[model samples]
Target: MKTIKILLSFALTATLFTSCYTEVVVDDFAYVDEPTISLNQLLRSHELWYVDINSTLGYGETPFLQKAFTVSFINGVVYANNNIAGLGANGDGFGIDVGEYNAYENILDVYHDIDGFSTFDVYEIDYNTIELYNPNNDTSYFLDGYQRNNFDYDFVFYDNIHYFLQEYEAWEKTYTSEYGAINEFDNENYLQFLAGGNDSTFRSSQDDTGINANNLYWDYTGVYGVGDVYGDAYLKTLTLDYDYLGNEYFELSVINDGKIELFHPSSETVYEFEGRGYIQYLKSESGTKKEKVQSDKLRKQRKDKVANPRENTRKV
Candidate 1:
């Protein structure tokens, strides 16, 4: 009787642990749409440009920049361009990649040359439109409706000299993830860039979500390009370094005015952030300039260290 009771208890404990673990997966997106057979011919003539992305599984919000990804079908080869200017050109940034793609009835196969992997089951909506979505799966991902781009727009890349965070910019996590991201702690986080420094505050924090009102800083110079989200979208990438949070590469979209966006970009992992607030932008001169007071203070510190060997230390 004792042995049976112990066995049952062990089995129940094992089941509880098994149910709690969430498996991590890659944010690999494939397109799925349904249209007529003539859609194949339509794809060969024009390019499919990434326009917008909506999170049905996460926040259900649309990204700010809509004209980033470009895909053109030529002969049997699929040409890819990202953050390329002038309606997806032929040289440099445009058509930098050559891959293969095929269609069999409603299903399309895309072979990415960079990844060296061919993805299956992504559908296209006829020939002129492509919606990368999976509505039937329990956990789904999508990129919506790549349109034909003809207008002349210059591509932009992220650079620190031109695109670093402004001192007064206050941005909350506007992007709540899909795939059921766990807060696991109390759920509020906010950050502000201030006067050559970064400050963060967390309200009602959680234990394991890595939420703390600790030190915050930039990891490296940011990057902005006609980068790929589903196919190839454009956004500014900022990798954040924090005392408690470790590192996070935030996908940012700069809309008009102070409006912007943040994306976590992992299919299996989730970050909880939502709601309204404006992002403050710094002028070109103000962002890059340093204050006289700060410079003088730093000089004094170095002077103090050199002035007093016993108070500080002299190595070598």
Candidate 2:
């Protein structure tokens, strides 16, 4: 009789363990609550423009004389320009003129306002040539007029303009993202939905069904253009389920520009605002500049040492 009782107890324990260890396989076709917030709404809510004044030079001794400007983007191209001008009206200054190369090439007599001073007869040259000019002091610099067949100033100008526009677009996209996040928090239904989930996921989509899991399974086909808002046609998916206490846990995914991104609710990745080039390309440009600067500094230092070897040795 004791053996029979022990066997029955063991059977009951095994049954309990089996029940607890069973895994629930959610059907691929199972229905999940659709996201109330649209992808456009999310992007618009979190939209932001991260502006940084890289280097600012003023107009004169007190304010500054020359200024360089650069605008970086996350989704768009980067634009950069150097403002060349003098301190006073009588002082020499540089002017920029962008037009059809044929018409504007010989017409170096461009006009513009430099620090509130209206000046005429500004010179127009290829950006490459302009890069060689010194902005600090008055120096006579000239661009060798190239044959029409040999030079493509129009192409260069177009490229520069395109780069600047790209940077502007990036700023706009960032601003939209920041605004969207703020709006998401303010929406009562969205917040409640978020709070109720134990494991919630969010993703951007274009499908109208508003289901999160479907978005994951579906092939992403949304193509974002410049200045496109998140909600215009694109959609966002949020997947979530609540624990016993109803604390929310969620996952987010969005179709940004052209790519689909899966992001954690708590962790957001902000790429450094680098313009439209790979790290290798940027590194190459930066490396070249660094090398040039170092070479120049070394040359100066070597000259000093040669001039006064004893004095230089003591300082070193």
Candidate 3:
């Protein structure tokens, strides 16, 4: 009877121990009630996250997030595509390494080489959409995840053509088609698009400055803008608002890496401009300008051909 009681007690103790161990294993390791996918896995799943700046809802801005057109997360490294000039070709399409990041649960902690540390609450909006909300700044930025194999780089390039114009110090008149009628634009030789203080700022020069941006004499300063042509991605309309000469509109086309063609609809002439003094932004890991060749020449109004009334060639 004593042996029987001892055996029964041993069996009961073993059963209790086994039950406790199994419960811990299920709770800690196989907790199905919680999300199975880790934050690291979710971030690493996409090759690129296109920062939808227009969708952003907040007054405060994130430095890194504000500058990046697209960002990528790969093996704890953060990559960003800041400029549109070399969109598909830079950093093998992943862009330059801006910083490093760590993921935990639904939070992402980034240590940018330039902007320092920033934390974001990662919320998965859908299968390919995520909202990165910065609690410190009360700002939320939406990102659309995409795989490299199916990404449309041309669309992105055309969508952000304004930034592309500002990449160069100046654009020199390189070629002009003999097809269009002669007009006052023939007197123009150089065009410079600026980035800051209202992105549409522009300066024009009639002097044959060649490829030297410093030697160029700006004759006119006004506003310039790039607009879409009836929701078309490939076609864009450019408007140069000259204060005295009115607005000059043209059909803008990027001929190549360093050349752009402008079609004047009224004169039916084609003008090709070559980029001079390229300015590559964020060339280093710490977000520094790579090659900036600024023109400090004095800006003045052009005295020649000021009588040509502004004509509405096409509606932007």
Give the CA lDDT, 0 to 100, for residue 13 in model 3.
100
Tens digit of lDDT per residue, candidate 3, span 124-185?
Answer: 88999998888777677789999877889899889888878888888999888978799999
lDDT against true structure, model 3: 0.80
Write out the backbone clash pairs for model 3: 180-268
Please report how far candidate 3 places residue 275 from its true position, in Å.
Answer: 1.4
- Report lDDT (CA) for all predictions: 0.36, 0.23, 0.80
Q: Is candidate 1 or candidate 3 better by TM-score?
A: 3
TM-score for all models, in order of appearance = 0.31, 0.17, 0.78
Model 2 lowest lDDT segment of ten: 293-302
Report the number of clashing residue pairs per model: 13, 43, 1
Residue 189 accuracy (lDDT) in model 3: 91
Worst 10 residues of 3 by lDDT: 297-306
RMSD of each: 26.3, 34.0, 12.6
Q: Specify the highest-TM-score model's number.
A: 3
Cα lDDT tens digits, model 2, 17-48, are: 77766532233223343433432232222212
Query: Candidate 1's residue-wise lDDT over 11-128, tens digit each?
Result: 9998877666432112122122333345356555454443322322322211111112445555656554332212234333244334567765534455644334343234354444
lDDT for position 93 in model 1: 28
- The stretch of ten residues in a row with the least summed lDDT in candidate 1 is 294-303
